[model samples]
Target: MGRSPAADAEFMMRDTTSHPPAYAPAYKTSVLRSPKNALISLQHSLSEVTAPVFRADELGPLDNDLIKNCAKDGLPVGERLLVHGHVRDQLGRPVKNALVEVWQANASGRYRHKKDQYIGALDPNFGGCGRVLTDENGYYFYRTIKPGPYPWRNRVNEWRPAHIHYAISGHGWVQRLITQMYFEGDPLIATCPILRSVPSEEQIRGLIALQDTSAFVQLDSRAYRFDIVLRGQRATLFENHVQGTPQ
Candidate 1:
């Protein structure tokens, strides 16, 4: 027999303690951004929960191929990488047709934004952004150059680890998640203040993507698998919520 609504709801309940506190002082910027008052929960209106449907045709044929989409003169200079993953709900059911967006600095650690005055030279061919929609089995993949680590002003000599930023939206506004995925075996992961802000070692580990040798393309690109659990005890650490979303 299928599960009842109450049982489904129970499976979706978030473990608040599993996530980092919004006021992590070590993270510095979170100080002023954290909530100043007690929070209130509200029920979602039908319009808020169900609008904004994303169609497959709305995406360009090269939308998911960062390596070629922005190429103008030549291919971007960096190690080729294939990042693939599956998105699942709290109950382990696939989240089909979910939209996954990614943006990152170039292999030299410089972003394409004008405000980014990092000394690293930007590759003319690398625009550093891409998007893809998950299949019926919640699988999605993208090709890009492995990003480089860069220094930040958070501390005197602090540097951010090489990582990719992700924004995933499931059916509607309420089913959205924003997180970062770090590569495995990066020594910087142990010391980066932003990653350290996570409450537990296990939760911090969840944000790291494992190298998937099995998926590596011969003489082409290395692959990394970063599955996303959308809710419950194993939810990926999302920047948008302290208490996880029901969706």
Candidate 2:
């Protein structure tokens, strides 16, 4: 068996603090204005965006600090979840040691905290958080429960669909990325905030909408499938933006 990542990076790690690369561009106002026409002609969207999938990975042994320090950082410590993604550099070459992080709303679309009353308190057993460091093959995994829909203060009190937020970092943040993974068949998807926030059609290029299944999860529970594309991946195109928004 391979040694743990903690030991693997101990000797090689220099400065662990990092600022990942920015998230992909925002959708064009015209495209985001309407959900019906947004996904039309999304041929090479991922190529234009940085991080594009949402996998429910359980927290690895290393995320204890994130778990104990804050409630906003709650992540399920142990559970099987659906994850998604592909491994390829911008030139189509595979990546090595890609890192992925995820944060999402609880079963009620509310965060785990004392103020979030729209939903109940967090499940003592579940933390709604996780992380995964890809292998040489550029793959990752996480175990988490399904996220619930929540209200967003959009357009006079609008709500976003059930979704999860994510970030990808490696080499202490060489080409890090942040984005969100969406669930399939969500009613609120019709008015997704991240999708609606964009006011540019061209910006709304890489929004994965139920195409590839291999990246999806195969499990017994109602787990969702999701995958992510780091800043550089062969075959896929992108619109490099160094900043990412909360999904």
Candidate 3:
């Protein structure tokens, strides 16, 4: 016989302990940003679960290539990288056609935004953003430069590790998930206040992308694999949807 709906749901239920506390004291900013009241669970309305269909034609041919998408004079100066991964649900099923977006600082660890006062210089040719939709098998890849680390005011002399910010949307508005991806072997990962906020060492490791030498482009770019699991026992730590699992 087949498993019941309740059984399947139970199997895919996320382990609350896998996620970090919203108000981690070490991550100072979370203090005021964390929720102040008890949480409430509600059923999703049709509008929240549906609509906002994505189409391949909506994306430009260069939308997935950050290296050239924003180039005006020449290629951006930095270590070229090819990041690829699979998007899977808690049940290990491929999440086909999911929209994945990524943005990061330039090689000097400076954002293109005007509010950023970091001393690092910005690359004139790099926009530091890109997006791509997953294929039928849940595969997605993009090319960009590896961002550098930079200091933050979270604590005296505190430095954030080099990382990429990701925003993934499944089927609807309610399915949008946001997270960060760190590179493996970065010593700063162990000390970053934001990363240390995560309680589980295993889950912390999940956020780090592994270097994939096999996928490297000869003499061009190095590759890294950072697969994402939407929810369940091994869900990737999403910053936005911390309280409950998304349907």
**Each model's lDDT:** 0.84, 0.50, 0.84
120-234 per-residue lDDT for model 1 (tens digits) = 9999999999999999999999999999999999988999999999999875455568999999999999999988888899999999999999999999999999999775322
Runs off by more than 4 Å, candidate 3:
1-14, 232-247
lDDT of 3 by residue, 1-247 (tens): 1211221222233355867889888899899999998677555455444435578999999999999999999999999999999998777878778889999999999988999999999899999999999999999999999999999999889889999999997654455678999999999999998888888799999999999999999999999999998753223436765334674
Deviation from native of the Cα of residue 52 in model 2, angstroms: 22
Which residue pairs come into collision in candidate 1? none
Per-candidate TM-scores read 0.87, 0.55, 0.87
> Using lDDT as the measure, what is the rank order of every candidate, best first?
1, 3, 2
Error (Å) of candidate 2 at residue 90 is: 2.0
lDDT for residue 147 in candidate 1, whole number 0-100: 97
Which digits, one per residue and each the tens of the lDDT, describe model 2 over residues 1-247?
Answer: 1222221121111222222112323332434444453233332332232333322264336452233323444554433345555544443444555657678766666777667777444656556666666666776555566667776544556777766788766432324557777765666655664665544433333443343455444563334445454443222213553223222
Model 2 scores a C-alpha lDDT of 0.50
